[model samples]
Target: MDTLLANITYAGGAVYIFYILTAIWIIAKKNLKLLSIIFPILALLEGLFIDWRWGRIQDYGENAQIVLGALPSFIISIGLPFIGFYIHHFITQNLPKDPMIDSLIEKSKSGAFGNDDYPSIYSLLESKIFEKSSYQKAIQNVENQKELINKMIAVLTDKKDDWDWKFNMFNEYKVVFTLYGTGGSYDPDNGTITLLTNKSGGFMNYKNPANTIIHEITHMGMEYSLVRKYNLPHGLKERLVDTLVYLMFKEDLPDYRIQQMGDPKINDDLKSANDLESLNSIVSKFVNK
Candidate 1:
């Protein structure tokens, strides 16, 4: 029974050592100054406890026997924790932030970036639309929207080649005309894209004909499940990407300035977000509507 008790005591000491080392590694890798201070204190306590228990074991044998039994306990209780903590700290702090996570989240939001990639009449005709026309003027307008969509996709997706993107179109269509403007939804799964031109807000702008088209394209890129959308609010990865999209394209969209629509400090506030809650706060300021 005494042997069993000693073994168990040593094992417990080792485990505590392991935990302390892991914490130390975490602090070092993250350069977390506060944790650095706390870690040594914890390690000291663990060492002290091990020493106290090992001193008690001396009653079982001569000094040499007690020393032999206590050595393993000292190594585990005092050494392992330091090693684990530093290892964890090194790996975690060095891992790169994921860009794809941000892309997925930005794509989920409805905004100008999402609305930037519209197909040109020429390209659509080559792929989906058929026939040439004496209506040269309308064809020219279609080409303009296509350019706008390409630029928007480039800015939002962080890809330079708009023409390289994959696209498919659904044969059916649905549309909505609201007081704010006309809008539509596109379904990528079924290859269907819809348009609702507010008789007043159709693709008429020479400067950004692609805006509506790109917006609908982005909607099509949404993940098929509503559960994903609902759960996204709880995550940080998407928010970071979405934040990147807005920051990259804000110059093209002066009307949607953070200062005009949100607290002037909104961007600054987001710079500190190392996780999803921070990202969410930034997104809410811009896209909660």
Candidate 2:
């Protein structure tokens, strides 16, 4: 029984040590500085507890002749820090933030109808005349929306060489106007951009519909390349998309400056400009090299 107990204690110590080492490795690889400090301490405490339990089991009687069974405990002691670090690192990495839609809301809020250029876009949307029949009017509305979207895409592509390259990658890319749902979404799998015309305060709510269109198309582009290239986390990817929107359309649609400011992921520690510049430098380096 004593031999079995000592083996069990040694095995427990080994498990803790293994976990601690794994955590340390992940933390160091990811450059998680805060976790690096916390994990080691946690591993230490766990190792001590295992040792204490082993000692108690032995102290129960005279058959506890394992007086110098301290080597395993000592080894576990070395691993405690790594365990603590791994826990911290795992928690921070996996903690859920606001949904992807919430990030989109933050990015699109300033441009929504009644906000920036919505009134003008709404007026343009209303200007088109169609047959009085409901079905015919809906069909005409869709056609007019497509014409307008094409015009905007043309302007954007003409202005930026990068836009042409990105937009042309998906040959069958089409924008469909929907009566409900989000401001816009790009489905790379289908090469479609769905624009919400109603439900979220209506399609007219977007201040710069052109900017929204461009932003969504940018997603289609980045979805193919940067996402795969960087292995960017969801939050970071949304921030990068926002940064791209800002960089591409800031001069054309100054209202996008508000959208840039509203990104929840932006912080004093992680400036959007710096992130944008870093990504741009990386892309430029890759292309030039």
Candidate 3:
């Protein structure tokens, strides 16, 4: 019985040490400072209790020398927690920082996506407050989009679809085809459409461009329905809009191929969109009035 108890106690001590060391390593690698600090203190308590349990069990079988065997356990219990804390501090202070993550954290902390703050999609579209300067390039985009809009309106006008859709003023948009992360937001509350793109190279092919217009336009159309049917949170509503846009636009692209990859080239990188064949395939089947 005594031997069994000694073996169990020794195993427990080994496990505790393993957990402590693993936590310390993660603290160093992931730079989880708070977790690192807290875990070490818990580890120390665990170590002390384990040693105490082992000492009590061992006293019954063998007179283990106090200074050589027991003193090391006590020292580790007292010192290891502080060592973990300091290691965490050093890791946090010395770790290389990512500016993008920092920016996101800052934005999150400041309530950047709050209801009262963001601009409406219509307003953003009208203002053309994009980070671009060339009016000619933007005007070309508008002209190309106008043709697509006309085609979509024609398609829908003939079909007796359930939804009432129209261009009231041309606020259609697509996410920036760039590497930056701004393309995927749809705010239901403010009716804002935030797109991220780097449009330096050139606009997407006109044949497929119309699909992009139809995509965003579809989102706008759905927002009206969602606004009437559900009082969803702003972020969730935005995501819903993105999903709907992607689904519809996938039918409008030239080859019926969807671009699943991402790019850092701003508006130049066209995301996966529906091809013309798919749109024609789906729309032709719809019975008209």
Each prediction's whole-model lDDT (CA): 0.34, 0.42, 0.34
Model 1 agreement with the true structure over 202-277: per-residue lDDT tens digits: 3322234344444444344333222134343312322333343345444654332221222334356655323223
Which window of ten consecutive residues has the lowest lDDT sum in model 2? Answer: 63-72
lDDT of 3 by residue, 158-272 (tens): 3414333321222222222221222223333322232222334243323343444444444555555443344444444434434434444445544433243322132122233
What candidate 3 gets wrong by more than 4 Å, as runs, is 1-132, 157-181, 184-195, 199-208, 227-251, 255-289
Which candidate should be chosen as best, given lDDT against the real structure? 2
RMSD of each: 31.9, 27.5, 28.7
TM-score of each: 0.28, 0.37, 0.30
Each model's total of backbone clashes: 22, 15, 21
Candidate 1 segments exceeding 4 Å error: 1-140, 155-182, 190-192, 198-207, 222-245, 255-289
Error in Å for residue 100 of model 1: 51
- Could you tell which candidate, 2 or 3, scores higher by TM-score? 2
- Number of clashing pairs, model 1? 22
Where model 2 places Cα greater than 4 Å from the true spot, the runs are 1-168, 199-201, 258-289
Ranking by lDDT: 2, 3, 1
Which candidate, 2 or 3, has the higher lDDT?
2
Model 3 lDDT vs. the true structure? 0.34
